[model samples]
Target chain A: MLLSHPTIGRLVLSAAVTCGLAVPSYAEDILIGVATAQTGGLAPYDQPSLAGFRMAIDELNAKGGLGGKYTAKLAIKDTRTDTAATITAVQELVDAGASIILTPCDADATIAAGQITVAKRIPTLTFCGTAPVLATAVGDNLFGTYPGDNLQATVIADHAYAKGFRKAYLLVSPDSSYTAQLPEYFAEVFKKKGGTILGTGSFTMGQPDFSAIVTAIKALPEQPDLIMTAAYEPDFPAFIQQLRAAGVTTTVYGADAIGTGTVQGLGKLVDGTVYSAAGYPTPGGALEAFNKRFETTTGHAAESAYEANGYEIGLILDAAVKAAGSTDPVKLRDAIAGLDKLPIVTGTITYAGTNGMPVRAVSLIEYKDGKPVFIATQTPAAADVPAPAH
Target chain B: MLLQQVINAISLGGIYALLALGLAIVFSITGLINFAHGELMTLSGYALLAALMMGMPLLPAAVTAVAAGALAAVAMERVAFRPMRGASVTSLLLTSFAVSNLLKVVFQNAISARGKPIAMPDWMAGVVPIGSFTIGVGPLMSIAVSALALLGLELFLRRTVMGAAMRAAAQDFNTLRLVGISANRVIAVAFLLSGVLAGIASLLWIAQRASVDPMMGFVPVLKAFIATVIGGLGSLSGAVAGGMLLGVMEVALQALLPPSLAPYRDALVLSGIIVVLLVRPNGLIPAVDTARS
Candidate 1:
């Protein structure tokens, strides 16, 4: 009786056909290469990006494959999160006939991959590479899904000026290339806004003790209203906890690194700190729909800027493929460069030039009771900050 | 500022002291650096994490961790170290390195697969305010536990007859064998004591960070090596003194240097060690008998 029902019969016939023919008929299988550090120091960033990328791929396939003909097949190679591994992974992906390649997380690995892709004339995208030098060196073949680190510094400085924090203590890690540049950027912005640098302190990476820095900060004659640190995840939590333990409860602010799991792990100790991030938590329109779909597919929260950037990178790549009408490397690159204003999960992204930085918006977030609450979205003013002379 | 720096130095020193003491005991008896010693500490930390996850209370979890460390050491001696006991020093050293690498890989995979920071209980969080400065309970507990462990170790090495046998074996295992003492027993006791010290160190290290990762042992072990070398290589008292001295020097350097020079702190400390070694090649406190030749 159930089999005889019209609706049930139609469903059975559709399932049989899909199983027998629909999946087997491959008009064209477009292979996209992903080289990421799935198992090393960069695993935290890479693993989540992998999840996001898969979610995007699944959604794209469900919506009738890219270019209205080919279904995307993501071939992933683990870079082991090392520079040497990243190079090898990229080579492997290229060997596997990947037309478009997604590179690893950090600047060094991403840059290395970018060089290879550029030499090979393949289109490459990075989800979280923010090294300023990379953006300047790489040409049109390379694109970043996230805003540059300069935007993060500008946003923080603007937010701090708005909050009446005119006096700031800058703490940076001299050993880190990333951290070293942050204070310089902040100093340029804060000084321009008429904020005084009260004092400066430094800590070494991998040094667990922060008491000395905390003691020095406490010893300042007039306490600064804000403490701005440019530190990585492992060091950030220790620095904040020790700063609080030393009875220095000054409002803390930092660059995009503050928006990582390391800060989240600090729990209540991270309360009352604010930072500038490249992406917003609650995206609108298509992004909102994508986020919901991403969460359902990934079975984890897509809350981080890195995850959003990864998802957006997938969407952009899909769009470029569709626009190019072919998987040809040069055509895809040209199509991507020609996009005037592509709305992504983060915000509107416009590629100014092949060598120029992409125009992207930044968001300011404040940590209230250990959660990064949305504050305001603002496009940072063009940085008037001069780069340090060689 | 002086008092705070001194307190910071002592607390930092306590961690080093525990690490060095654990290494010292094993080296004194086995004549091996036991490169795997740091990994033992890491293994104990992970064991404690596992125990905590299994709903054991803090104190019981700590005890289990210590037991696990001791058992792991015993197993290492039986399987790896014991086979190459009388071989060239190079063979034993290579075996230790191999053991360390194997453990590191296993722990790294285990931690990564879990993909979360090892959780600590709620009671261990926050600071206990005292006067103008607030001290973290973890650091305070580290100092206290290290002191107690050191005291207990001193008592065990001096008071018990088994302790006398251990000392004799360290001095001359062959002579101890002639005196009808089992060298195996002495070696086992040394491993057990080292495990206990490593377990205690793991607790303090975890308390300070409130998380455990496989790479956690790398720095601690390096510090321990430095402490042992700065302390007379074979002297237990030297280990303790050297650990305290290193901790104080590190804090002092941090306080004195400007922020820009902070990254060079390690280089500066190593330079100081070289100067000390140049002045006293046998270390700050040379081993009493070994210094003669």
Candidate 2:
């Protein structure tokens, strides 16, 4: 009404234009709530993904924030790898006015955190909730950026079957949902392919000795052609050492959990062991370039492909935010769902119609000379991929 | 095959015995369980890695690792445990527990929660074969080192003046004090001996794990603590016997249990121990009590 005055309106319009041109700062800020396992058992897995987020956020800011109008700030809270603590952390983040929440990598903790966020209608993204059941369990508010475990299982199963290996002995660790559900998925796919499971072995996480299991495997009348597992870290290395030292030369296969730099530490002990990977650090490629950038920024070579998995999350989210043109959780969730063939550090990811799980290629990598060697990137046919276990 | 399994059991049991004996030494002298004994082992493993990284030769690195444990134990006693001298058994146990968790947190936050790979010697991972039977070198070294450490402890306790003072203190601290032996010195020496034993046990553990993490000491310490309880607390000989028996039980279960029962092997081993404890409450080789008068 005041601007309707002929002289005053012309003067006010000129002043508004002048002020708008005077500052290059953002018009809005987006607070990203990060609840992750920063200091406990899951830290090794979560920290790398956090590093990728940091790198991606830095790049995003460098490019004029979000579409030259908004800047993102991470409000991080440590979950400490406890489910109850995770619940509290997510609530605290939401209460502090976060528009989006990032959860810990493991499914149990992610679900614990997501329940609160989903109730608040906030968008939640898991660092690496590979379990397919997470999509249904947590509803549409949650998104898992990491490749689903079922996809990796199918790829590994198909590859093993192609090698004329019909018999498999599975070593299962009931420690985490990732470790527990992955072997079951493999068995599901492998059995469907007409292969027989020789036997199964179980262990709690971080079992200091695998000699007992090794001995039992040795006593089996017919040795398995290949052994499959999703065990990680110190446990996996210990198992491999004892298994090989006992003269069990069967080929070993694994899920994405085994595709970390930790196996490189085993040197020749892990040679010929093939595992499904979320991404590979290809030479002179985009992933390698990002790795170099990560090294320059953090002063350490990227520890694992998890770093790449995390980088992909950032790129995908940034694209989602741009496509949405707003930071509202609903709009952002919708935008995320509409993403298609988006290139990230790892590879192209498609979330459209994937039901919170991204459809992406799974890399198969082998250890040679104590280093990861990329074999092939596999994308199982939609018909071949087993449905997510309810 | 049976012989090969027996060898495996002995080496695995040897580690338990070595660690249990370390705990026994501290408990005998100070009446404290030294729950941090496991942390001492963890410190030694990290020290060994750090030394090797610094271009030290294998022998010197190992010596440094052992020495690191001794120094940490002595310092821990002087700085943390000494101020509470004559405190109740429960109080000292809690203090040690606090100390153990504190060190593990430091290892988790200040260092890393993830496991760091320990570059092992080739011979440690290698296996020796004899007439269609193959045995791992790690087990053999564990057995040999454990035997040497035990024999050395025996000679020290029976032969040296300081060792005699320690033994006397174990029997009766007041009588040793009446004869002019300083309680602090004797307790410090006991800690030193225990730390050295823990250091050796760390090597055996690292050989099997091939990696070091903040929680690396958890299982070993838990097993050794169980062995101590089964062997009769504060009795060195009992601790060794209990550890050996526990190892043998574990091997037997592993060899006998069906594949379906493999995961329950540890559970069965524990149940068998419970039965043994029921039969012999004071452990297999209970310590003798000396006459006060």
Candidate 3:
């Protein structure tokens, strides 16, 4: 009855205009703002996800756009992994009639860019950030589109327990929150699964020499069943090399931090190493097909599971857009929060009743003959998952 | 346990000493710290990787790395620094910083931000038994190769006419020119020798990490600079001693510090250096009065 009144309907359109909501039209452009790092230390992590995100966008365009009507256009801005630059890029995107926003794969940069989108009341989410704090850091509008570090650590611990690895030693790199906190959560989850932490050894990331840490681990009264460290690139190579040189060949476990092509040339040195990832290709599953499309589109193989995460971002946007029946940021944000068991290329993800981080299955992967071989995808039991670190 | 940690200290120190000696050689002759010295190492690393890709054997690839470093240094001196031959110290230092950044950006754009994985020699990845003690073969090679490089540089500096010319230039460049020794040759030889040392350091660095990136030389060079200062700037032998001391102090703290305080190891080493400087302002082995005045 209210919509039947022409004057009242005109007032509603004015109100929407005043609130900075773009009126959705059947053939109008739906701006998906992408403010991510294209170059810098974060580039290695951000680029592959960007490639997958582009693939998803291309697939949507082929299907006559989102919800088979409005054309989705990606308005990309490179943040260059700088905080001030991230803020500026986010502001520029919001001013350019953006409907939804994507942040970088890092927590600091995500929070930096998300702060502006939050202030603007736009729905924004990190494409591949694993930090749990992002869910609560940048107001209620920002959401996490990646698996949390706590969840990954729990999956690792649960899998390690299944492999009969009971005694663990944590290699903590206090230099990064990702490196530092993942091991703590792994310790908690491992303890819950009837494991004892033999000891904790510390090292700074990018430390060229890991001999001191290796010596400390070798000196442990009991050799750990597993050594868990979230250290990546340059650091992981040196650590694995030194650990081998010390003749202490305890199984090493890690998270997605080392999931890049870092282990490709490592050959037998890292053959048995295990780590958790957001997704991995099953023999004939959706992820395999998605990866094939990614290679054909990007002219290179998907670098990491982050590519899978990126594609899921598109599925989420589509689901939210369809549910909300409009591109308004406020409406889209509520629609996304209400998504339930939405199936993706990786696995089913549910955001309903969550603070914003999704509940998704994690893939346990291992390197065999210098190639990543998927082992299993499992969602750790709620009791085994550790509480998110502050 | 102590012996193993000691071996670790020596190996790590060898790299610092090698780099510090290289930095000292350039500074002693040119009166410029040459921050781009780090880029020399990175250049050598990429050259080594390229050589490996060309199907060269490991031995020849190593030679290529060393040669590439030397040639790059010579070219760098000819192109960038030669123009400002008599510039003030600040001007030369700033130029070197700019060159360093320029090279890093080029590497990032032309190559990649990710590290290129390098599969090292089997011996480097294995352990060697010294009687009842086992040590990494890579670390052992670092110590031996660096010692050999240091000895060769010392012999070259002491026994050759070019070496005396370099030392004379360090003491006072104008005086050397007054004596009719060519200043350009002395400076050129200084950069050449510095590059050779950097090549050796780069090999050791890559052996440890098994990968190379655009800015891989940054931290090693930073540590080497500190060692040069601690050893007294412009003193080659002092730089070596300072590097070994810094390496030893680092290992000691890493071994002794509690887990909660381990992150402070770098801060502690720096503070200790300050104390050493406070006690003896000229460094452990200060250079002979760099200026006759």
Candidate 4:
């Protein structure tokens, strides 16, 4: 009101005109609240994924803000891999008026943040919440960017069955929700496909000795057709080394955790190791282009599967916002739920009837010469798997 | 299979034994747990990695790693712990923790909080078969190195004046100081020996795991601490025995537990430890003359 006085209003108008002539002003930024672990134990996974998300955001903004009206700005909050920190970070972002919230890769770590977004009625997308029930369990506002764990497990089971491996031995790290769930889903799908599970073993995280597991395998009446396990590095490589050292030549299969620089460091030991993870880009595709850009930007080629997941989440959010035709959270959430065949850098994500699970292609890759060799892309049929046990 | 598993047990036991001995040495002299002892191992591993990356030969790199550990231990003594020499036990214990966390944060910032891969020589990671059994060379080396280091430590303690001084200090530091022995030198030597053991242990550890992280020292240190407690604090031989027993128990349980019950093997081991403690409140080998006024 003070500025609206006749003489003052004229002076302010002249000053605004002068400033506007010197520098163009951008419209208000559409805020994206990204809650991820940038430090602590999870940083190895979260940092790379966050870089991918940043790349995607940069790419989107380069094309002139979302709908040419609002620039998509990130309000990144580091959860430090702590539950309390995740809650506080998400709350701060929500209070700061984030239109949608993005969460970390692990379902367990993101649960608190998901609760906040749900309570606030803000649409939330997790970059790599592979657990089957993360979406339904979290809330109606939660959407998973990656395919459910059941899908990847089913993908591995189907591929193994196709390879004529009907008898399998399973090993799991009962250390985290991610590792523990792999064997369950794999057993479900493999048995449904008429494969028999010969034996199973479990261990804690950072339990370096796999000698007992190897001994157990050797005790079997006959060698199993396949050896399957859910593991991450540095345990993964050590386990493989010990298994090979024990002269157990049976073929091995693992989850996406095997697809990391850690396991790849195993050199020839990694050869012929088959694993299922989220797909990367096809040649000359958007993901391929993004992968190149990512290498240049981060000074390292995308090293983990979650990196792709991180990039895919941003593209997914953009598509949902465009489809909703408004920034309203309810309409955006509805549109996100209804998204079908949305082309992403990783693959097409369809969210129509998946109970908030994204239906996307899971990659079947074999290790050859210390790098993943693409075998084939697979979309597991819903009939070939059992429903998640909530 | 039984013989092979025994080999595994010995291999695992050797690491715990060495780590426990290191912690025990420092604890015996200072009555401080020296939780930061693990960071000495971590620093040595990182130092070795850096030296190797800089094209240093394997032998010299190993030496440099050990030296790095010793130096870090001495540095910690001078910079963090020395000033608190006459402080209360509670403060000293808390200082060790603060030092441990501070070192971890420094490592996390300077290097990485996550595991960084270290290339092992083919010989280091190779396996050798003796008749019907195969033993990992890395594990074999751990056993041999621990045995040799233990022998050396034993000889030093019994035969050398400095080692005798350490023993004297462990029993009664104030008395040793009253006799005109340098308390500062005795403490520094104790730290030096502990760091050297940690450095050697670090090499063996990285060989098996093939990677090192800030938290890499955590599990080993935790196991070592448990071993020290089980063996009897302030008793070096007890620490070694405790570590070996724990290692054997863990490996044997892993091997013998039925497939259906294998997942609970660690819990079972912990239960066994609890039972043992219940039976013997002072641990398996109570330190001599620990009934201090």
> Per model, how much of the real contact set is kept?
0.27, 0.40, 0.60, 0.38
lDDT of 1: 0.74
Poorest stretch of ten by lDDT in candidate 1 chain B:
B113-122
B1-293, model 1: which lDDT tens digit per residue?
66677777888899899889888887776667878888888889888978987999889999999898888888888888887777765787789889987886677555652223444554455567678766655566768888998999999999998888987876777888898988778888888888888888887776656556555676787888899888877778888988888888899999998766777888999999888888988877776546321
Residue A32 in candidate 1 has what lDDT? 80
Which CAPRI level is candidate 4?
acceptable
What TM-score does structure 2 among the candidates reach?
0.89
State interface RMSD in Å for all models.
Answer: 3.1, 2.1, 1.4, 2.1
Shift in Å, residue A349, candidate 3: 2.3
Q: Per-residue lDDT of A67-167 in model 4, one digit per residue for the tens?
A: 54557866666677788888877777777667888887778766778788887668887777677787667787888777677888888888899899999
Score candidate 2 by DockQ: 0.37
Clashing pairs in 1: none
The TM-score of candidate 2's chain A against the true chain A comes to: 0.90
**Model 2 steric clash pairs:** none
lDDT: the better of candidates 1 and 3: 3
Docking class of 3: medium
Kindly report which residue stretches of model 2 are placed more than 4 angstroms away from their true locations once superposed: A1-27, A64-68, A323-326, B259-261, B265-293
Q: Give the TM-score of candidate 1.
A: 0.84
Clashes of each: 0, 0, 0, 0
Write the candidate numbers in order of decreasing DockQ: 3, 4, 2, 1
Q: For candidate 1, lDDT tens digit of each residue in A1-390?
A: 345474465365335332332222233777787888766556767777777877777778877776665688666666766788788777766765667888876767877887778876788877676655654566668776666666667778888898888999988877644677777678778888899999888777767677777777877899999988877555676677667655567888887766766566566777778777666656564445666777776676665667677777777877788889887788888877777678777778877553434668888888776577888888865645334311
Which regions in candidate 1 have their CA more than 4 angstroms from the true location?
Answer: A1-33, A58-75, A91-101, A114-118, A137-141, A283-292, A301-303, A324-337, A354-357, A383-390, B46-109, B113-139, B175-185, B286-293
Poorest stretch of ten by lDDT in candidate 3 chain A: A17-26
lDDT for model 4, please.
Answer: 0.80
Give the Cα error of residue A373 in candidate 2, in Å. Answer: 1.0
